[model samples]
Target: MQCSQDIAAPSEVGAYLLEHLPQATLITLDTTGHCPHLSAPLETLAAMETFLAKE
Candidate 1:
């Protein structure tokens, strides 16, 4: 799942998933809104590309 910046808000447990799921890559996109897919599609795509390229 693509986690946007809002997930970084205080008390957001979803952000902790990255630490919990070390096996799965956690792609955190710095976005201004709640939906990265909508607010920053190009940036989000670039971030996804970078994430996918990681081992």
Candidate 2:
């Protein structure tokens, strides 16, 4: 998962991973910072739950 406004890693990194890694999932939280789990816990957890449910 990645934050939309994350500068440390950036959304492009997630995009690249998603493109290169098989079955990879990219969740972009609509917030700032690099740590989505800390900066946007609920959204992060929700995204994780949703993804895990699919798996």
Candidate 3:
């Protein structure tokens, strides 16, 4: 899974990255940059635990 937080999406660099990817799992945190777990540690951990458990 790929996670991103408050990052620019319209840049050519961003578009280029998207072009090379296949099916993706995106976890977009409500909080901005500078560590999403810091803002929502338990929520992030729970999501991660659930995802990991499935694997």
CA lDDT scores, all candidates in order: 0.66, 0.90, 0.55
Misplaced by over 4 Å in model 2 are none
TM-score of each: 0.60, 0.91, 0.49
Candidate 1 per-residue lDDT over residues 1-55, each given as its tens digit: 4545474453245557656877866565666666777888898889878878884
Q: Write the per-residue lDDT of candidate 2 for residues 1-55, one digit (tens) a residue.
A: 8899999997779999999999888888899998888899999999999999997
lDDT (Cα, tens digit) per residue for candidate 3, span 3-50: 355354423443456667674345554555445577678767877888
* Candidate number that wins on TM-score, 1 or 3: 1
TM-score top scorer? 2
Winner by lDDT: 2
Clashing pairs in 2: none
Predicted structure 2: lDDT? 0.90
Backbone clash tally for model 2?
0
Q: Rank the candidates by TM-score, best first.
A: 2, 1, 3
